[model samples]
Target: MKKKKEPLKYHIFQNITFLLKCIRREHPLLLIFIIMQVILSVISPVFGIYIPKITLDLVMGSADTAQIFLVLGGFGIVMVLSMALSGMANEGKYIMYNDMRRYYQMELFLQSLSCDYKNVESEEGQTKYQRAMSTLRNGDWSGTSIMIVSSIDIVVSLLCFFIYSGIMSSLSPYMVLLLIVLSLISLFGTRQAQSYEYKQNDLTAAYEKKLSYVIRTGSNAAFGKDMRLYHAGGWFQELRSSLIEESAKLAGKIQDRYFASGVVNAFVLFLRDGIAYSYLIYAVSAGQITIPEFTLYFGAVTAFSGFVNGIVNNLNELNGANLQMNSMRAFLDNTNDPEPETPLALSDLKEYSIEFCDVCFSYGTDTGFVLDHFNLKINAGEKIALVGVNGAGKTTVVKLLCGFYKPDSGIILIGGQDINNFRKKDLLKLYAAVFQDIYIPPFTAAENVSMQELKTTDRNRVEECLVKTGLWEQFCGQPTGIDTPMTKEITGGIVLSGGQQQKLLMARALYKDAPILILDEPTAALDPIAESRTYEQFHEIASDKTAVYISHRLASTRFCDKIAFLSNGKITEEGTHDELMQKGGAYSQMFALQSQYYQNKEVAAAYAEA
Candidate 1:
């Protein structure tokens, strides 16, 4: 379904209200500081225009020397005081802006972390996420800080416009009207330029996202070996160059529009100043107005033109800032399925039996179902192996069971209750999983195992899990023992082998000690014998927990109580290893082929060694 577009006024009001609430919550005094800065800024310039006129008029009139000195002294003192106050207010505003910018950035980060996992994985969702992140990262160009500053500019400019209009009217209302007309023409041109830039925002964001991806991938040490071995650096460079050239072309188009707007503004200013100055000079020479009055009116006319331009420019900037705010709000609002008003508590459940009934799921409307009418049941404390080839929906099944993705139809039940009944966070607490991909953060070994800070971690539990996973002796032999950092990027840190990293993940899962344990190809990095040994060790450690193991190595399924072979989005074969072999089906054939391949390889290695 298409979303209805919001009006410009609605976007402006809603974003402003949201930001004001943020300011109030984060720093209430910031608003006062901003207002103080604006008022002083406006007043200081007014004094600059009027004080000279007053001083000149006093000199030319019959005013005595003492009176002239008094006037000059008061003007100097007021100017100094205004400058000092403005400085203080500006300094305070700057500090507050930095604080608010950090607060807003953190809010965006938190929102990204908490949003639905499906959204994180989807293309449209990633685009929105990148756009929001890019908008916030460009602190001076767009986001909360720019929006707040642009809003203040509009208010200040409007205030100046009204004050200057009153001054200009004193000379002639016709002059004020002429200035307004010329300013409006310039404003129209500038607004056109701004609109063009606004329309290109999505394209610009796409380019930025691509450029960021290239830079990130190129710089990551993890990809360094692949790039070198495959000689792919030139390919990456060419891709980056192409993107940069295209982005530069787009930027050139935007700059051309701005340049045209500038030309129009310059022409309008030329006409306005020529007409105002010529009329004022004629009036003074004709003895209709005094020189002091001419000076005052001329100053007011020039300043009035500036005030008009300020209003136009600030309004354009405000609109741009509001557009970026809308992007961020859209991303933050893209939430997953709403939880029920009263979600079932995980603590109320005793047994952790899992069941999937007539379930169907697909990644998108255009994609075929990865799982269709898939039904499975695992009694409490039972161990099952789900064996399937790549893209056979084994991982999808695990993801659905873990509530990372919801099925399009049918139900997944846990302990006889619908999985949807539990809150996502609470549902996740019932299972501990180690998947194929591993990410070990640059933290101490103990922190990595426990997935907690040093202060809060149970040292004994972490040690116990490490020992069970066969990593305790290796860690203890290191200089820093379990306190050693896990990444080479950190000074005095050590990088683990792929096999060791897999073990670390296993330790993490064991530390959680949930009722259900899942290992999805988690031992892929280990040799076949080592992988089998690790699986056996994990089985012993999680003996009482309901276990689900997924692997293509059929030999490993021997230890499982039951083995279900998946094919074309359904379980096609199910039985113990001996039973499946005796049935002489697809599972039996695949297992025989794998066994023969491994045996031949072992013979070939032995012959080569001899």
Candidate 2:
């Protein structure tokens, strides 16, 4: 279904209201400071226009020296007060603007974290996320920051326009009307230029996204080996240069439009000032107005031009900001699937029996189904081995069981209830899954294992898990023991070897101690002997829980209560290891092939020894 496009005014009002509400909730005093700043900014110009006229009129009339000094003193005092108050207001707004920037940045971060996992994995969702981040990271030019200033400027400029128009009307209403008409013409040209610039925003965002990717990939330490060996630095540099050139070209085009608008504005200003000067001079020569009135009216006319220009420029800025705000709002509003109104509590069940009944799913509409009519069941507390060749949708089954995704058709049940009946977060509590991609943050070993803050974590529990994974003695040698940072990114941190890192993840899963434990090729980094030992140890540790293990090595499946061989998104074979081997099916053939390879190496080693 296509979303309806909202009107410009609707976005303008909605975004402004939204920001104002945020300010009110977070920092209400900023509203007062903004109002103060606007009033002082507008009134300062009023003094510039009127004070000169008053001084000149007093001098021309030969007024008393004391009276003139008093008028000058009053002007000086007002100017000083305005400057001081304006300075304070500027400082307050600056501080609050930075605060709000950080506030909104975190809001964007949280939105990304809490949004649906599917959205995080999709290209369209990633693009929206990047756009939102880019819009907010623009500092003063960001939608949130500039909207406040632009809103205030709009109010200030409109107020000045009205006040200056009234002053100009005292001389002649026709002059005021002529200036407005010329200003409107200039405004029309400026709006067109702004529209053209806005049209290029998508191209600009794409270039920025590509440039950021290139920079990040080129600078990553993990890619250093490949880059140096393959001589790929030049390739990255060339890509970066190409993106920079494209971005520069886009910026140049936008500037060209603004340049054309400026030229048109200059011409209009020339006509506007020329006509006003000619009329004012005629009035002065005919003695229709005094010199003091001439000075006041001329100042009013010039100031009015500025007022009109301020209104036009700020309006354009506000409109541009509105577009960026729309992007930010869209990203923040990308929510997860709705939870059931009265969600079933997964914790209420003492045991969980997982089932995938006629489930069909694919990552995207264009892709073929990774799991088509897949059906499987694991009784409570049973240890199952899910083994399959690469791309056989083994991982997809685990992901579906864990509620990371919903099937396109059919249902998944846990504890004999539909999994969708439970809230997503509640469902997640049932599983402790260690996936293929390993990530241990640059935090203390204990913090990494516990997945909690160092201060709040149970050190004893972390120690126990580390001992169970056989990493306690290794970590105890470090300067901070288990409190040692996990990655070298931190000061005085120690980097873990591949096998040790795999052990650390196993320790983390053990620490979670959920009812359902999943190990997906968890021993891939270890030697064959060590892998076998670790699997046996983990099997003992997980004896009380329902566990699912995935490994390509059929040797690891001997201890599992049941072995399910997945092929073409279905279980092609299932039974105990002995039963499957006796059947001499695909599982048996694959196991024999692996066994023969190891046997060949052993025989070759023996002959070499003789």
Top model number, TM-score: 1
User: Model 2: per-residue lDDT, tens digit, 152-185?
Assistant: 9889999999999989898899998998899889
Error of 2 at 411 (Å): 1.3
What's the CA error at residue 144 for candidate 1, in Å?
A: 2.5
RMSD of 2: 3.5
The CA-based lDDT of model 2 is what?
0.87
| Clash count of each predicted structure | 0, 0
TM-score of each: 0.93, 0.92
Looking at model 2, the pairs that clash are none
Please give the CA lDDT of all the candidate structures. Answer: 0.85, 0.87
Summed over model 1, clashes come to: 0
Flag regions of model 2 displaced more than 4 Å: 1-10, 286-288, 578-589, 592-596, 599-610
